[model samples]
Target: MVAAFNRFRLFHWLLAAFFLLAYLTGDGGELLHVWLGYGLIVLLALRVLLAPTKPRGFPSLAPARREWRKPTWAGVGKWLTFSTLVSVTLASVLGLGMVDNGEVVAAALPSVSIDVFGTRNWLGGLGDLENVHEFFANLALWMVGLHIAYILLFRSKSVMPMLRGLSPQGPGSAPKGRNHRQAPAWPALQVSSKVQETPDSCSFELTPPAGEAARFAGKPGQFLTLQVPCAEQPMARCYSLSRLPQPGQPLRITVKRVAGGRVSNWLVDNLQVGDSIQAMPPAGAFTLERTDADLLLLGAGSGITPLLAILQAALLHGEGQICLVYANRDEVSVIFAGELATLQQRYPQRLQVVHWLDRRDGQLNVPALVQAVQDWQQAECYICGPQPFSELAGQALADVAVPEQRIHRERYSGVEPAVAPPSPGRPSRVQVALNGQRHTLDVQPGEVLQDALDKAGLETPSACRSGVCAVCKCRVTVGSATMRSNQALSDRQVAQGWVLACQAEPDSAQLQVEY
Candidate 1:
């Protein structure tokens, strides 16, 4: 029964992807016309055949805060999920009704009015059902508009894993530097040794199993979390996978020091041999969106993590025609410079590495960026950098005529917006659980949970304090906690009472949030 209900999730994502692609890049209207009708019948059939497995409860669509003290905001996510389901449901029902009357012939399906906008004349099987499908398709378009509108008003940086069919890390958790311990949910890449390659940069090679090379399983453009102990502060931080998913070979990540960052400073200054660290299984949606010969790899600061990984994967995968533009302040800050130079020397024909030095050249040369990507008209782009750098790269790609969708990006951490401190007058109480003990504190009303947790001298595990990452998720035992993250939670997870403590506040007096 549980498995059957899970199929709804699987089917929903697959169908959503299919329809999304169709609508975005195909003759979605006509396809949707037929697909909708089929979907309705399928939903019904599944309902009957998998009746025992269907969810017992239906979500309340009514815009009321009865269940929630604050309104459940369901702008784009709600609209997208609901509209896709509705569009497919309506079209499928109408199509089935027409098909049951022998109006649509399987043989005639191919020749039927495929262009929902092509011809009004619904010949043969397309008779009246075409009009009905058209209506639903238009309605679907409205839903799509509504979805976008909702996103515009209440857009979030973190997209939930459930909506996309993949479970992401939880949204919030303990503040920072609280002992967070979890064993390998997957075969973790063990660090054999942390060798000093250079004064500025170090090489972290994973310790393989049975003295074999350890290969991490993740996309070329995906990232993983590393948790090691530090004397000052100890918590895991996200690092881009710098190598493709190698089954048994060692995967590597290069890190440079950041001034005030606890983990970065610790790694560059105090890391040593025999010190093991905990790594969470891989997670992220910003994967190698796709591979194209005409590739543009951009990296600034540590944003180079995933881009370098993608480049390695491209080479290992036998990809050709690539150029990497690495921007840093100077040679002192250039990370993985040696490795990139070696790659350039080896694949001189297919790969080109351009180092943009802030000392010599002011910033990335706009014209050079344009020239680097001109060979392939239909090329895909992958970029990683700080917020400003990434935004600039996006604009540069657009200037070169690359479609918006073709340019993919990944960020381990980002610059946070200014957060106003919570008012001192109105303080609210929140309870957080660490290990097994629950600690409650009277937090300033609307004060960020992380801040409050810190004031109380409780160590909460965290990396990016921004609500985008799920380093702070805890299970809610008693009262509901509000999530301020842009990444919305799913109905099922919400019903299960999981909340991101970083983005949360105590909504109920007796609230309990636990890891």
Candidate 2:
């Protein structure tokens, strides 16, 4: 689900740009070109604010032809979206250029200096809109017709509110402490305390918070962003889930400390078993195929967590042979060893485990890995671990001709990830609401919100200060900021415009965030 949202975000961005170009060249107001982006930017912002809530109603896929909150000019939103979609399509058909500048122009009139389809212009000496453009023009016309039909079909229902993001689905879908929309308090939820999974990894389970924000949603291979507050400041980080996401079960995370990592070192050295830590719900794209096909699990180091969850699920219910080949620097670095041993003991015939150490094996041999999986040509493979190693293992699978459909992956990290929110420019400050105290920060250029808080002598919860850890995750109830990187977020967040404060900077005059 998270992955789907992430993919949708990419499309929204591109579509937004396209809309801007189309509006600029149209016969409409020139400000439409620039202001449209801002309005849609706000629209994207609203998407986040509104997503947490369920849509009050649907647009009646059964097109209505009646009075449904008029789509006339006063209904700016519907008009903008409909107009943009239609105009772009028409421009595409008329072979109207969408890009500005030489040989390309959008906003007002498409570029027709050289028509792909030989057709005469119909409008004055300016000529026709272009023949190739006709295809898209007709397509747009059909969409508008359909939209109108749907509205008329559902006459009394308001389509505008739905499109504008105006609903919140209560219960079932709204789990505890999972909401990014809720105000941030010292997160009240606590998962099960750390459990030693293997010498290298420890698991932390959680008790999701209450209300519409609580998180009861997660799938195997998904990840969570953590917020760890310090007496003097807060930090954030993102971690992949080692335990699969179950409906009512506690959210579980298995973390492995790496050499020279500040947050990892802190987690291993300072964190207590009973102490509570706040976090965003499990979110990520990697996971195992929840099917009864032959399965292969691969990992180079800690990356084995998500793959383990996948394997565990399959073993408990799935009926298929599961083969796992894991490589590490040494025996000590192999995660979930005891669990694997136990699994092997229980399902001796159905599961296989192969361990390799760089020191003993003289680095991983691609030929050996390829040979190991040669028997399971139809198996689905889930892999995770070190970066270069993950890349190499993925490459090895591909070189050996593993089908793309069969591969999924995950990564573990202490450093801030690059996946931050899409925001405007550097901010001068941020308003933090917590403990009933409002703290204002004077931000420096290139500094994340975490840094500013630290400078203010206020401690907020956080993990990886760089942004990978969501420990410093905050809610922007008002105003906007940019994410340092977006790797840690699922598509749901990037669209709603939630950014990692540890990596984001403000754009508006004053910004407010809930931590």
Candidate 3:
């Protein structure tokens, strides 16, 4: 699901190559030009189908908080991209029509008969069509030139993200220190044991047959993507490893029931010891590197799962002092409460556990937090929780003058997307291409892409409809669209023209999307 957006890199490159090839091999190189034109048409159609479902990345053109501020370059880029798509599409259509008129087709070459404009009256009746075709072809060339220049002038730095999927890690952007190998295939693992940590939370120990621990061995703070075979479709969910990996102990993951979570409740109610389930190797960015700096780990609810692993690993490695600020609804809801107490008892001088109960303590006081730890700003901080908890904790850390780079954060629930307002326009048509089939959807003035696609009966990959997951990402080949929010895609990914389909809305009269 996370990898869906990156898959378009090949298509993007191929489209550009084909466009250049077709342009370079004109009538003089009829065969080459003709073949390239056919390929370009197919590719352009695919792009049109993908436009409505484009992956929404971090928008460069987000609106300013103050309404008085002028529009951003991203706003201008939206129109420019749409114009480019329209012009290019026009050019491709005209070229195809001209070829079908038999002007460029040779007797010896294989040709497709698709004369939308009858060839019998080419010069007499089709003169206007030929002229319009030539005009759009020229306009497309100009648009392509301007588009390339715009990217070079303003978004030159984003070239790498277009080729690769990830944003470049600057210094101190959360330490992802573990060297990960290629992800192994999902293997069936038997549930060895289960321990109920709280009324709504439980820990499951899963082990593969003997000699499989090495494949499953993962760094602390990484998560497992579990495949649950539900009654409908197979569902996949990520869970953090709650314990540090050991030689003989099975891999353990903790799960807390979400209010209306289907997978979580199913796992808690249906999973039993000796039952086999599928799981992939661990993967995530919320990991702690072995450092000498004292650590301040903050967690709320089941967010403690990853932090617990980090704490145990740090203790085993003989790191500096560690302080944990764990928050829960009450004492009963605290996961790993006994384990945390045991660790604190064993490392009296090194570990400090501050358990805050929401029922009694209310919100964490920033000044009190600052005063609680000596040299608090100096310690490397890691925070995990639900979206609100993580944000509030991060803000508090900032108020205490902790370096922005020093504080790291992770969230168990997906974050909401951040989106710029739609470029001023009303789009009416949305076309989708999926699994070699094309479907057209009528989009209302304020309708989003996902809704239109749904109404049209095309179900694309999606989780966290808010755009935190890139599962519903598709490519925009024609027209223009805007996303409401996009937390999952990096700025570079946005620059490459990906938009999250779930949050997307057409910005032009017609849009095409391909997945």
* Candidate 1, superposed: residue stretches over 4 Å from native: 1-190, 208-216, 318-320, 365-377, 412-420, 424-445, 449-501, 504-515
Instruction: Name the runs in model 2 displaced over 4 angstroms.
Output: 1-186, 197-200, 209-214, 246-248, 417-486, 489-515
lDDT per residue (tens digit) for residues 1-515 in model 3:
12334445446546755665667666676566656666677766765565443223212122222212544555454446567667867776666666544544444344644443356443345577768877887787777788778878887886676666755443212223231122224588899998999999889998966676776777788777777886486666778889997777888999888877778888998899999888766655566753335789989899999999999987765346888988888989999999999998887878899998978787665665555544667777888898777777877788778876567776457332344444445557877877677888877766778777777666566544555445566778898877876544544456667787878877778888877
Error of 1 at 383 (Å): 1.7
The Cα error of candidate 2 at residue 55, in Å, is 31
TM-score of each: 0.50, 0.49, 0.51
- Over 4 Å off in model 3, which ranges? 1-185, 209-212, 414-515
Q: TM-score of model 3 relative to the true fold?
A: 0.51
What order do you get sorting by TM-score, best first?
Answer: 3, 1, 2
Q: What is residue 262's positional error in candidate 1, in angstroms?
A: 2.6
Q: Rate the local accuracy (lDDT) of all candidates.
A: 0.59, 0.60, 0.69
The per-residue C-alpha lDDT of model 3 at residue 89 equals 72
Candidate 1 C-alpha lDDT tens digits along 47-107: 5464333232222222222213432443235436555656756755554454322233333
lDDT (Cα, tens digit) per residue for candidate 2, span 241-343: 7776666677777777767666565665666666778776665556543444568888777777778778887776455688999988887777778888999
Instruction: Give residue 352's error in model 1 in angstroms.
Output: 2.7
Shift of residue 362 alpha carbon in model 1, Å: 2.8
